[model samples]
Target: MLITDRHGRILIQRVDYRTTCLLPGGAVDADESPAQCAARELQEELGVTTTVDRGLAVDWVSADCLNAPASMRFPGEILHVYDGGTWDDEQIAAIRLPDREITSVEFVEPARLPGLMAPGDARRALSALRARINAAGPALLENGLPIAPTVLDRALRTARARHHLPFHVGPVPEQLSVVQVWGWLLAPDGRVLVLLEPDTGAALLPGGTPEPPDRGDPFITLRREVCEEAAAEFGEPLFLGHLCEPDNPYARLRYAAPLTRLGPPPVDPATGRTHIRILATPEQALELFDWGLPATDQLTAVHQARARLGIPRAARQPLTELPDATDLTTM
Candidate 1:
């Protein structure tokens, strides 16, 4: 099985007998299923009990390719890789290794595994990571790669009608004069950061109409608004799509980013109060946004972002149940 932290760092273990590290897995017992063996091995090796979900990939280690002595090498082996879901820092810290077999456990970046792990093991881990990302959603390439437009991209391009100046959505008649820019800022754990309007008690993404200083770029406007509202910095931004109101000409140019840094929440100049919430799932976002069309579009963008970033989907929750806002002070 392949295990990784929330940020996609592979959890590698150094065996006492082997010079290079490998993933945390072991042979399946005579009567146990692969999943059962994976869970058991994780518990025995790391003293951590976690569910082994869907299989990620499989590796066939040929007898000729074995690095062990001829006597120790078997005819062949088929290894099953499973997805060990993301773990928090505390869970990672609690991992206790069996020193007799495992010398240590460390989280290593995927790119660095090639140098630290056996060639075959490194290939297996990298393959599993790619499979996990592909299964999660559309593959997101590194910056500057030639990426073809995805289905979401095509839809957005076709739906774009007219671009207006940025404006806020409110009860006033003049509020619809321009489009709005909304940012879907996600944390490493896959939770989204949302802003709460103190005056209206509405939960909103950290953005607003572009101010004059924004220089007319939606991305720049969103970056500035996110910093101003949540005291957060945007990572590489991915243009998800446009959320056009059916009844009105107003639309929201939505952008998604894995937040780079988060500081103390500043009072939004527009709202004059500070209260930001982190939603654990898209369903919670929908409920917090009152199940409106904009919320639905935001949910879509969130899904797209998760797929692009290779983040697993958050656990499913009741569609109508609203979770309490996690105040910025607690974040």
Candidate 2:
């Protein structure tokens, strides 16, 4: 079973027998279906009874692929992964592991799985996680490799190389140069705009560096870049925060702006690269962004700005490409 908490951290176990951490599950018993086995294993391992639905992934492990004791006679196994659903703080608090086998349980960030678990296990877990988030039904895998891989799966293949910027929810320091300006361009429904690279599925907020035409003004750069990248217009922007990396004297500023008009999909004039525009809730936006935990604080700042700007919380929905000319004034 693949389980996650509200913050998107996956539940992994430290078993006394294995050096690599494992996702909470055990061998399937006879006369039980995969779903039944998932539920049973979850309850037995974590002492929590939750309904398991939607097989996130199915993997066929070849015989002799696994490292096992010589006497165990390991045969090929068909593995099933099911979504255990997101657990709340109270539910997490209620978890009780047995006295043996599983020595401890941890809710770890998905990015850390590679360092903690076996390589194949890490790949399978990540694929399953992407399946759940993509809402594209189940994924098929062979030895933890996706048969028909997803955009997210492909993007996450180099998880260790992802860049992270330390976010600060305050004014950009006066001594530092404001290097880039990005907008948390929020629709009336409170979903923020995210720009996706058409080919690589890389995500970014719609903004850019200050151009000569921008007169070195961050807001002007924001407006021009938003128009260039997402083909959109917005009302006054409220500065939410900035991000700075170590050994750098520059800051990347972020603002929350109410989107006024959304035009058709845009092909960035500078790069001539067509970008996909999508509106995602702050939580989903955080997932799409590769930044680490500090991204959460940035979103929290965006939420405060949203409340002050009187934007409504968007209802949960699957992420889809932004349609042309969504008039927000009438929404």
Candidate 3:
């Protein structure tokens, strides 16, 4: 199992009898699958319970290639690596170590893995890390298998680029008038709720600029704007962070989540703006935005939300024409 924190730091454990560290996983019991073993071992060794998702990587290690002592070497083994989703500081702090076996647990930066683990183990960990990175972007898979060196290299490049990328919203301008907030309102069927501007037939997330009554809280602003613009009530918004262009520093790109539509949408009063919402798959949404005036920041925010929610990237394809705009005025 490959466990990590929100910051992408890998969680490694030091065995009581070993000098090299390994991930929090062990041999599967007779009745357990690899995924079951991963989750059970995590809680037994680390004191936290987490879901073990699908395999990230599967590696066949030959007995001759093993880095352990000759006496301890066994037959070749096939390892099933699963993703132990990101945890926070509180979860890390709550770890309960079984001193008899797991001596210590610590999160280590991926760059330092070479010095901390055995060569073979380090290679496995690095492969798992790359898989996690690729999970955040467009993944390269063929015939149910990930392309070897290319996928790994692409993931490494993405990870390096993201580490250096700036994600900050610039200094607040004195005359900043509107703090715009939006929602990536997801449905159970994996469709995203979007709004269409009636006048220009432009696509937008279901949100708008904050009004005076918003009380300066972005969450509050989001709730109000979503209701006013979409005529549908949403649950409390989870802040997904911000996006901003260098030239438009005052145009804040705030997103919220756990979006639940309470009822049927009523027609919006705002002139030239359609209240009719569009439920599009992530791929369709991308194409729709491409056909209209693209809101790059909104698209970025959508990707961020998807990453946080563990949603896979949609496969890209060309569309000859855009979908018909939904007209709220007729509703």
Candidate 4:
């Protein structure tokens, strides 16, 4: 069972006998199906009753893969990884553990699984997580390795290296000044444009600080910066919201606009670097930003803005280079 909390932390169980922790599951019984066994195990072990409808991954483990005690002979088995579903605070509080076998359960960040579990377990957990985000159904694994990985699985590491920035999103404070501006510049398909730094894999949206020539208008700053950095033009802009950081006097403004025209990639005069432009779904963009759980709120805002704009939700696809000479007038 691959269980996660609302914050995307995985549920791990520690056993009395094993040095390494395990995901919350056990051996299957003869009369129970895999899904039934998963539910029954949860009830017996954690005293929680929940439906297990989604299968995240299936792996075939051979006998040679097991590390068994000399007294116990190991046989190969087919393992099924089921979606335990996301648990809220109330549901999590109701969990009860059996006294003998399972010692404790902890919700851990995906990045910490490597240090906490065996290599195979860690790999399977990560692959399962990526599959969930992919929203493309379950994946197939062999001994915990993805046989055919998704785009995110190939490019994104479970232990995503991210820089933590204190950020809060809401209406811009009346008294606070605007320091920087960024836009969720959307294409016809509702995918947002993101600028990627080739050297660091860092991603950012188009827009930047207001320039002296802009006369202090944030919209002017966004227009100038988008053209300079992305070689793109956008139609009328819609104010999405602003983000504030503690002790910072200036608020970072965010907007959404339909991309009008995209020219060939050009060297940004301000930074002298040509960033790789990518169009990603909102979910994929959140992973690329690597802002942890708070990103969910930002995503909600994004979807709300999308609704107001009447843009269709973009389907999940592998990250690809944004093509130049694209025309959205037809859309």
Each model's RMSD to truth, in Å?
17.5, 5.4, 14.0, 4.2
Better of 1 and 2 by lDDT: 2
lDDT of 4 by residue, 1-331 (tens): 9988766678999999889999988888898898999999999889999899999888876667777664453556678889988888998999999988898999977778889999888888878877776666788888788888643554334344553444455677788899899898878888888887655545678989887899988888999999898899988888877766677677888888888888988889988888778778877777555565656666787888887888888888655566465666664
lDDT of 4 at 72: 53
Error of 3 at 100 (Å): 2.1
Clashes in predicted model 4: 0
Candidate 3 lDDT over residue span 98-172, tens digit each: 858998888766656768988777777777665554444322333223455431232221112121113333444
Reference-based lDDT, each prediction:
0.63, 0.82, 0.60, 0.79
- The residue-by-residue lDDT of candidate 1 on 1-331, one tens digit each, is 6776644467999898879998898988899999999999999999999888688666667777776788877776667778887677899899998859998888766667878987777766766665554344322232211133221111111111222323222232434444688877776656666655544434567778877887767878888888777777767888766655557866667777876676665777776787534444555454333232344444666787778986667664211111232233332
The full ranking of all candidates by lDDT, starting with the best, is 2, 4, 1, 3
Q: Roughly what TM-score does model 2 have, to 2 decimal places? A: 0.70
Per-structure clash totals for the candidates = 0, 0, 1, 0
lDDT (Cα, tens digit) per residue for candidate 2, span 225-327: 9999989999999988888978989999999989989888788998899787777777777776557667778878999999999998876665656757677
Weakest lDDT window of 10 consecutive positions for candidate 3: 156-165
Q: Name the lDDT value of residue 110 in candidate 2.
A: 78
- In model 1, which regions exceed 4 Å deviation? 68-75, 136-331
